[model samples]
Structures are given as structure tokens and as C-alpha cells.
Target: MRTLFIAIASVLLAGMTIMSCEEKDDFVPTLLLDVQDAIQVSNRGGEFSIDVLSNLSWEANTTANWITLEESTGEKGKRALSFSVTENENDERSSTITVHSQEGTQAELTVVQESGLTLNIFVKEGAEGSGKSWEDPTNLSNALKLAITGSSIFIAEGHHTPMNIVSGGNSDDPRDRTFEVASNMTLIGGFPAQASSGATPDPDAYPTILSGELSDGNNSYHVVTISAPQSDEEQVVLRGLTISDGQADGSKSSATIQGRDFRREYGGGLIIGGSRVVLENCAVKNNTSDKYVAGVYVFDEAEVTILHSKLNNNASKSNGGGLWANNSTVFAYHSEFNENSGGTAPAVHAYPNAEIYLFNSEIRDNKGRSFGAAFYARADSKGALVNCLVTGNESTSSNGGGGVMMYDNCEMEIISTTITENTIKGPGGGVYRRKGENILSIYNSIISGNTQKEGTMNIDVYESDADPAKILASTSGEVVFDANGQIEEDAAFKAISMLGDDFTPIGDDNPALTYGMTPNHLKEIDYLFPESEKDWLDQDFHGHDRSGSTTMGATLPE
Candidate 1:
């Protein structure tokens, strides 16, 4: 019995030894990925690098794949090594390596874009009749010459002396004659119209003018002909400047024959024959031409964006006293046009084959003679106005659209806008959508307060033989407010107070605050539930809360 016990013990000991050997073979350390170091990021080529460290049995582990260092450029590369990771070979303490691949690697490379520079522009200040004074340091006419010649000129906040810009190179003289606005630049002036002293004895006279006078050290002599950009990447940004009285020099005989002819041919605040231009926070006022034209005339398939600007008090002989766009794609946002008069046609005219988009803009107080007061769109024009205000416009003798008068076969859409307070001497005060397979869609907009000399709310659809246009509206949406999330009718309850002569707004318990609400479109529900949160009232340009819940109008304080 004792011998049998000894044999059994020997067999158990042998089994236990085999089990221990198997457990030892399965013991493999985990490979750790380590990347903690300063990396070189190249902007020109979008290259970046990060070092990686691995400390484990990488040789025998055939399943070990790679160590990836993720970056914002979205690049990832892999390498497989067959070796036990030694401290010297596997530990990358301060090694830098390039990431040659930029693919689906979003790990640590989220780049947040910040706002670009703010360009402020100032034009002539001190009242309309006062000659421009240099008391304010921002008289940048001379610096503007250098800036307009290239890109990025910041006009100061002082009244500019009456000046003209003449291109140094003449087409005929060739005496080192070359003038160009050839760079992607930001020109900023007319910021807050400074107050200074210069005598403008004639109350009717303009203090500063940009006319066709090249020889008297004035630069505006060279017509700003919009030629093709030398490169597609170039941009021209005009901001915060006032352009007044850009007249053709018929009064001066010394003006170049070509220059005078160019002025006579194309005269306005800004004449566009180029592409990809942007105008923001500007005022184009009181520009006139003898021939039929517009305050802002665009042609030749230009892609123009007009934002936060005012085009007012301009006069023209024929079409488009305030704005004229021909065969172009134009987007206007947060803009205003007031009190423009046209002799022969509409205040805002779009030719055939034009695509115009207006967003959160106001068109009011415009007058025309024989046609629509606010807008006259032709056939083949595709237009859309979202959250807009078109009111208080008039026409003398004809079918006038205090809001809009579209011809046959035109396409138009309006969303969440106010088309009210418009009047006409003849027909169609609200809208005159004429005959011809025109498509008109209106959703969530107010079409009230428009009156004719005889009738009111005159929406004439297909008065002649034309296809009835479609006017669509959301069943739940209303237009008595603006897209800035306020009620338009509420502003009428409280009288708005002006802080100073600037006519900027300062809100004080106005009832016009609670109008627009888009709950489903809310980015965050917490915005409406700001319980015990501090009120951050931001004011607009006219010194009012642009996004306040207590006031009306566009000026929001920052």
C-alpha cells in the first residue's frame, strides 16, 4: 500500500510541473502606446508629426499592428515590428516623426476657427455741409490710395478731405503709368461718421466727392473698371465706407477722353463687371447719373454678396434707382434701402436670367414713376426673399407694387417677411404678380398694411393670360416679426429713443420684443430656460439690442 501511494504522488507532481510550464508560456505583457511630446506642425503643406513609444513583447506577438499618433491634419500611418520591445528600441521619449498621411484620423486634431480681423472704414464726417476736417486722426485718403491699389486698407475715423484717385499710368501716355486694385484687400472707412469742422458754406453742396478728376492729385480719376481677377484666389472686400457723388466729369474738359467716356457709360456708386466681390457694412448714398442706371449696378455674371449695408437716398433716371442686377447671382443679407427714386422704372430691378436672394433685409421708402415702387422682376428671374421687410414704397402712375411686381414666367419665393405699409397711385399695392407661367411662393409672411390710393391688399395674380404662380406658406409660421426672433408689430407699442444725432437705438421696455419663436429650430433648449442667468444684452449698429427680447430694429450691441 505504501509503494502504491509513492507512485501516485510522483504522477501528480509530474502533472503539476507541466501545468506551470504552460502558464509561463501564456504570460505576455501588453504593449503600451505612448505619445507625449511637442510636435512640429507645418502650415504650408499641412504636415504634422508625433513620436510613439511601445513597451511590450512585440516580436512574438504577430497580432500587434501599429502605434498611431493622431493630429488635426487627419493623418495615420502604421508600422509592424517583430522584436521584444527593449527600453532603448521601444521607448520613444523625445523623437519627432512626420505624418505623411492625412485620412480619417479625427482623434486629437479638431481645429476651431476664430473670427478674422475686423476692418473699420471711415469717410467724411462733421455734418453734410461742413467741409471735411483733419481733426480726427482717421483721415486715410492718402493711405487709402496705397490700400485700394493693393488689398486691406483701413480708413481712419476722421473726415476725409475732398480727394480723387488718378491711375498713375495712362493708356496713351505710358509714362510708367499703372494703377490697379489688384490684391484681395479690405477697405474700411466711414465708420461712425466722425464730427469735425470744415466750412461747407453751401448747404446743398457735398463736402467730399469721388469724381472723374485725375490731374488735381485726386485718385478717383481712373475709372474702377472691374476687370478679370489676375488670379481666382483674389477677393475685394469693401466695408464701412460711404460712396457719394461719383459723377462723370462732363464739367471738366481736361478729363481723359476715355475716362470721360467710361464715366458717361458706366456711372454709379459701384459698377461691377468682375466676379466674386463682397460688400459689407457700407452706405452707398446720393449717387446720380444722367443716363438710366442704378445706385449699385452689377453685370457680366458676377457673384456678389451684399451684407449689413445701407443703400439709400439715391436717384437715377431709368431702371433700378437703388439696385440693378443683370444676369448675376446676388445674395443680400441684413441690408436696407430707403427713399430711392427712379425716373422711369422700379427701385429694385432684376433683369431676365438673374438669380437674386435677399435675406432679413428691408426695402422701404422708394419711389418710381411708371412701374413698381419696390421691386420689378422680369421673366426668367429667380428670386427669393427670406425674412425681409418691404414697405412704404410708392409709384406715380401705373401698376405699382408697393412690395413686388413680377412679370410672366418669373420664379419668386418669400419666407417670414413683412410686406406692409406700401401704397400706389394706381393698381396692386401689396403685390402685382402678372400673367405668364410665373411661380410665386410665400410662406409664414405678413401681407398686410399695404394700401393703394383706391384699394388695399391688392395681390393681382394672373391679371392677364399667364399660369398662376404657387404661393406656399407654413401653416404654423407667421411674418409679423423678423428672423432676429422679434415681433414686428410689437415695436409700435413703445416709442424708441435715439441716443444722439447718430439715430442709434437704446431699448427701454419696448413691447416689440416678444414676436418670433422657433422652438423646433432651437439649437439649445437652455437658451429659453435661462433661469437666474445674467442678462447679456448685445446692441446693434444703431446702438440697440439686435438680438434682444425687448426692442425692435437691427442694431445689436456687442
Candidate 2:
């Protein structure tokens, strides 16, 4: 009995030893996660994924879950994480995997998106007794070249001494001869980093101040030639510069290019080529071309955007004295076009093929010789004005538009805007729509106190033709207004009144502000204004509660 028991016990012990050895052979090492280093990302929007490496098993049950990956601290609060494998390699000895995560979204990886390569230009008084009393502008050329290689160029605050650099480079290199401003490259000048005491005051405060000068040879040779070598999609941006005095054709200037015409010379500020460009926070003033140009000129194939800028006191012989868009696409936001004088439309002149959009802007105090005193659109030109103020503009034409003139099947949409106090010498004082099919859309807008020195009504469409039938009432069309079913004829003003040259419209306890649907265009946009608080909708200038139950345009009276 004892011998049998010992033999059985020995057999049992041997079987147990073999079982332990098999378990040891099957054991898989688990990888440990370190807590310190981790990936970072931006918290702007969207979910991020993170991958963790593991060699234990291929089963989904063995894979790490979100809860296991998350780490929380008493002071730091809860952490969120999602996991995904970007790249993976499976092997018995080692497995590698790239993991992505939104874990520390607020904790972003260090990224520097340099707005652009900058050209810092410092212009100071020339050295005394050096005979260089006249500051040479050649340095600007060199700096411009260097800046062109990069993204953008900034011309520091300083008066540019008189010097002419005809853009045409060496005769051999035609491309070089043509001073080409490439895509995504900006040329900025006279932009104050911070408010300065003695620098040029804000044009809003003082409109008559002469802030910029150009002394190069007095001929019209393209001073600033804006072009986009790339396709139209990739646009170049130019802003914050004061450009003037550069001639298009003159003795000291380069040979006249095809677009160059002293009488028809384009932009005194910028000659826009076939490109989609943006100009922001700038001043296009004191620029001139004899024929059909103005402070800012847009050609047939160009698409331009101007925001938060000033086009003031510019002169042109023919078209737009302030801004001209000839068969182009243009958009202006939160801008001021004021005190400009020209032969045709003074503030803005658009040809038939042009499509223009104006929002939260002001066009006032402009003088024109021919027709449109404040704004002009002709030949199938389509324009939309939203939350804008158009007033105090004058026209010299026998049939003129103090506020706006549309001809040749032109279409216009005006919404929640104040078009008042405009004067025209001719028939259609406030607005003139000629033989062309003109469509006007006015909604939640104010049209009062407009003068047509000799025209029909405060807001007149057809001049000589007194046919009320011909008068195109402000309606929906190629022109459209967002009334949200609440359209008003007239709201009596209370105690508010217009004051000073500013003439900023004051809101009363009118139904327009209290009960109105904010224009649809203003509702959907990314507002990028420079403000500390981010309460208003993106790109909306009218300080209102955007997320409220009721929709409205621009201003929301408290």
C-alpha cells in the first residue's frame, strides 16, 4: 500500500511540474504605458484619435479601450482620449504602432504659422549734409525682392521719400522687369502696430489728413503692379499700405505696358490682375489715373475682397473715382469709401459684367461728375449691399443716382441699410435705374431724407419717364433681401438725430431693430474682427446676440 501511494504521489508531482512549465511557455509580457510624454493637438473642433502599441494578442477583447487610456488627476480634471492605429507591425518579438489622440486637445503641439515672411522697412530722416537729403527708394526695391521670395512684406511706418522704381526689371528678364507680386504675398505699409500719438490719425477721425506720399519720377509707370503668377484660386493678399504718387507713364518711368495708359491707367493704389485677392485694414487714398482708374481698380478677370479698409479722397477722370470694378467680382466688408471725386460714379463704378457685394460698410461724401454719386453698376452688374450706410454723396449728371445707379440689366440687393441724405443734380436723385432691367431688394432697411435736387422722389428709379409702372420698386430679384416676413414701410424716429461729419446712423425704438430677421448672409460666416470678446457671430458687424431664438440683421437694440 505504502509503495503504491508513493508512486502515485510522484506521478501527480511530475504532472504538476509539466503543467507549470507549459503555463510559463504560454505567458505573454504586457507593455507598460508611461505617463509623462504625450501627443498634443488643437481644441478648435472635431475628434482626434490616438494609437497604443501592444504585442499581447490579436483579439479585440485584448485591445486597450478609451477608459484604460484616459488619465485623470485631482487638480487637472478628467481627460478624454480616442485611439486608432495609423501604422502597425505585428511580430512575436516586437510590435510597433503609431497612435493618434484628441487626449490633450487644449494642449497643442508647438506650431508656428508665420503669417508671412516680413520686410521691416524703417524710413528715417536722411543723413544731414550727406547730400542724400532725398531718401532713396532703391532700398525698398531690394527689400521688396527679398520679401517677395517669402510670403508677405511689411513696409514699416515711415514716409517713403521720393524715388521712382519703374517695375520693369532688366531688359533680358521680362518676368524680372515686371515687378510681380505673387500669390499669398502681401505688401503692407503705414500700418500702425499700436495706436500712435503723432502718426496719421484714423481716417474715421480725420478724413482730410494726407498720410502718404510718393516722390519717384512724376510719370505714370506702374508703381505697384499686383499680379498672381499662380491660378486664380491661390490669391495674393495686400493690406495695411498707403500707396500713392507712382505714375503709370512718364519720362522717368518704365516703358508703357499693355495695361498702362496715363488716361486709362488703372490703380494708383493697386493694379489688380487676374487674381483672387484680399485687402484688409488698409487705406487706398490719394491715388489717381487719368482715364478709367481710381484709388483701387479691378479688371475683367480679377476677384477682389476689401475689408475694414478706407478708400478716401481719390480722383479719377472716368469710371470709379474711389473704386472701379470693370467686369470683375468684388466684395467689401466693414469698409469706408468717402470723400472721393471722379467724372463717373465717385464711390464705386462697376461695369455690366461685374458682381459686387458690400456689407457693414459706409459710402458717403463722394462727388461724381456723370451719374452714380455714391455707387454705380451697369451692364448686367450685380451688387448686394447689407447693413450699409450710403449718404452725403453727390452726382453732377442731369440724370444721376445720389445713392446708386444701375443700368444694362443690373441687379441690386439692399438690406437693413440706411440710404439717406444723398443728392443728385439730375432726375433719379436717390437712385437711378436706366433702360437696363434694374431689380432692387430693400428689406428691414431705412430710406428717408434723400434729396434728388431736381429728380422725382426721395428714392427714384427712372428719371425722365414718370411712368410709375417703369419705377422698379425695391423687390426680390437678382436682388434679394431677408425680411423674415417682417417688412416695414416707415417707422417714425423718436429723439435720435444725425450728428457731425461721421453721420453714423443711430437706431431708434423702431420695429426694424426689435423684430427683424438678421440677413441670411450675415448669419452664416466666420467673423474675424479683432475683438477681445467673441460673442457676436463671425464676420457680423452688427453687435447682436447671434444665437438667440429670433434672427435679425446687424444691429439688435437693447
Candidate 3:
């Protein structure tokens, strides 16, 4: 009996040892995965897979309803698990899929989706609830947090400041909060929504205002800043909005242009850097900066297109008051710059390889303490003025350009533009041509009523190159008026049709009306916004058609 018991014990011990060895040979110490930190994806729902390497059975599960796995349970041995996601129609989302082994070892895989345009993010003032639906609205600062790429945020009709401050030990309006708008997004204002039926979305009637006037006279640095790099081809668009009452004060920044270091605080109303932006039917006014530009500042790689907008009544201590571009481009279509006062160019200033292209716009009633009253442009750059009215500007500083100051080596093409009633305290009432042989091609344009305190540029400096300007008829006179109110040069040129005195179709014959009405006699004119195909304005500045009246100016008679 003792021997039998010993044999049974030995057999049991041998079986137990065999079982332990088998389990040890097939054991996996740790489950390791070779995957990216995060995966970036796009709009539509599609199949995605991830490889899992293990020696046990694994099951995949996700909390997001948009995610669907083809197979939940899998025998893990370096195999790919396929999953599908639904079409996204909201803001950008990040979802994670948790994978678990039979031994309770968990791993996560995350997928990120880009924001879609179908989602509507409505923002109003003084609402502190969830911003999901129209019934519960949020403030602009909160909505900006959810504003990702390719998103559209609708703002309501109220005074929306960038920040709402609460006084405390150190929380008393630091003046650092700004509307840091992202690239490839749209911010449309003038929306009034409550529960269901919002207003008809009239910008003027609703009057959505974005003010930077913080309490206790603590102003923000910038009202709006569009400085993010683009993920797509879409631009940062602001439509039917008003950017006003901003004061860009405090710490100055440094910008380099043409190997020169410029230091100043820039862009009180709007500052654009390394992005494409558009302002449609908007107004940028009542903004102030200690130095640099007050209304708009376009930096490197930035393209700002203003269509049917107004830049008025902004002030700066130096440089541009309305608009300034440095090493970038600014194109305006049917826009107006009026009543901006500053040092240098008050209406518009382009410098250090920047370009300003204005088509069918008006530069009027601006005051500049120095340089050009309408524009101060330096050479090593290019610009154009087509179908524009430059009038009622004054260069307060002595020996400045009344209408425009073209300094150093540069090129500007003036076609079918009217330069009238602009005065300077010094030379170049029409234009101050400095240094090198500047390229000022005044083709088929009118230069009248421009004046300087002394040595007016009407016809005084014909000795300069390309000067005895190729001019058309004028309403009054060029700078210093002559007996005949006409320039001395007789070079006749043809150009595209621009605006008359009131941007009204030429109805009455002015004093310097000398040419005849013939479209075939005009040369082809290069205009801006080639995407619109036909160059000339279908409707004039006031949104009125040019009635078929054969006139003497440069516009094509329909």
C-alpha cells in the first residue's frame, strides 16, 4: 500500500510539472504595440486598421458611436483589425479605441478628424451655457475655443469683447486677451438668434460690433489676430462685421524688412500674419495704436483682400493709420479709406517689397502728419491704382507729397484714376518722386486740384523720367492749377473706365473733358481679382449701373 501511494504521488507531481512548463513556454510578459502617437484623418468615414502583436486573444471596443469595428474579438498575433467611422459633420474630433487582452491588459489607439463646414457655431453675448444647439448659446470667447480649421462661427448683434474680466487679486484685465482667430475659418457677424427664428441677417440693421474697450481703460493688444498656418486652401474670412474701438498698446514687437529692424506696436484692429484673409462688407474704424498701423497690418506671406469694405476714422502715432503692408500684399476692391489720421501715410502705406493693389476704390479725407497724405510708398515694391479717387487728403508735414509719396526705387501704375483736391505742405502735390528715376506711369488718368505749399507737382518737374504724365481730362486742375486747368504733356493714353466725382456714371461734362466717347479707342487695362473674369465693375461704387451714356472719361460705354 505504501509503494502504490508513492507511485500515484510521483505521477501527480510529473503531471503538475508538465502543466507548469507548458504554461511558461507560451506566456507573453507584456503586450507591445508599434503605432503612431496620433493619427490625423479627414472628413469622410472610411476603413482604418491597426496591427496588434500579442500572444493572447484581444477584443476592441470604442465609446464613440461614430466608430464601428468590423470584428470585436480577435486572436492577436501581429494582425490588423479593421474599423470604420461615420461621416463627420461637426467640429474636429479625437476618438480613442480601447483594446483589451483576455488577461485584462489594455491599450488605446486614437484617431483625429478634421473639422467640417456643415456645423454651425452660433455665438452671442452674455450666454454662459452649452454651445451645442441654437436654444443654448455661448459667448464669443467660448466659441473661439471650439473654432478649429474649416469651421464657421456666426456672431450675433451685440458688443462682443474678446474677454470678460472679473476683478480679483491679479485678475483685473491684464490686456493680453485677443481674438486669436484661426486660419481656414469663417467668422460671420450680424446674427440675432434666440430659440428658433433668428433675424433675417442684415449687417447694417443688426449691427454686430466687436469692441476691444475693456473696463477701467484697460485695452487689449489686438482686437483680432489671424496668425496660424493654414491646413487647407480656404482663407480666414470675416463678413458683415465691425472691428472697432481697439487700442493696441504696451510691449512693442520687432519686424525685419529689407535688412532693417523696425520696432513698434502694430495692428490695433486687425493683424494678419502668414495667412490669407478677406474682409467683405465690413468696417474697421475707431481703432488706435501707439505706433505702426492702427487699422490693418499685413505681415509676411499674408494676403488680405478687402471687398466693399470701409477703413475709416482710425488713428496711429506713426506710420499708417488705415492700412499697412510689409513684405506682403493687400488688394482692395470697391473699398474706401477715409478720415484716418496718423504720421506718414494715413490712408494707405506700402513699404519694403510690399504691394498694394486698389481697384475702383476711394482714398479721401485722410490726414498724415508727415510723408504722403493719401499714400506713402517706398521703392523696391510695386502697386497700382485703377479706377480710384484720391481726394481731400492733406500732408501736414513740410515738403511731403500731397497725394502720394513714391520714395526711392519703386514702380506704380496709375490707370483711369482721379487725383484731385489733395494738398501738401511741400512738393509733389500730385506725387513726390524721390531719388532714382521712379516708375510713375500716369496712363489715361486725371490729375487735378492737387496742391503743395511751394513747388507744386502739377507740371513743375517735367524733367523727371516718365513725368510729363500721359493724362486724360480732369474736373479741375493738377496740383497748381494752370490757366486751362490742363497738364502740359500731350501724351494721350487709353484705360479701363473708373468712377466719376461721386462714383456716379459720368452724367455731366466737367471743365477738363477733352476726349471723345469710343470704347475701341481704349487700350486693354490689367485689373485685380482676375477670378471675377471681366475687369470693370458691373455696378459702380454705390451699386448702380453705368447707364449707356457716351462719356469722355476712360470707362467703357455699355
Q: Which candidate is the best by TM-score?
A: 3
Lowest summed lDDT window (length 10), candidate 1: 105-114
TM-score for all models, in order of appearance: 0.52, 0.59, 0.70
Residue-wise C-alpha lDDT for candidate 1, range 1-558, written one tens digit per residue: 223434544554455445546775553222212222232111111222322212121211112222223331221112231122111222122222232222211112122111122232333432232122334333344434333213344343433433322332334532111122333456554433333343212212222323232344432322233432322555667666566554322222222221112233233566655456787777777766545554676666767788888878877766567777788777877788788887544467777678777766778889887667887778688776655667778887666566787875677765545566677776567677765766765544445446765633356553556554333222111224344434454334221232212212234542223333232222222321122211221322232333423222232223
Q: What is the lDDT, from 0 to 100, of the residue 72 in candidate 3? A: 86
> Tens digits of per-residue lDDT for model 2 on 94-139?
1122232233212211111122323333222221221111232223
Q: Which pairs of residues collide in model 3?
A: 379-409, 448-477, 449-477, 450-479, 497-555
**How much does candidate 3 score in TM-score?**
0.70
Alpha carbon deviation, residue 403, candidate 2 (Å): 0.5
Candidate 3 residues 180-296, lDDT tens each?
A: 664367988877644344545678877888888776576765677676453345678999999988776645553322222223378888877767899999999999988878998
Rank the models by lDDT, top first: 3, 2, 1
The per-model lDDT (C-alpha) reads: 0.47, 0.51, 0.67
Give lDDT: candidate 3, residue 512.
29
Model 3 misplacement above 4 A:
1-118, 164-173, 193-198, 254-264, 459-511, 516-534, 537-558
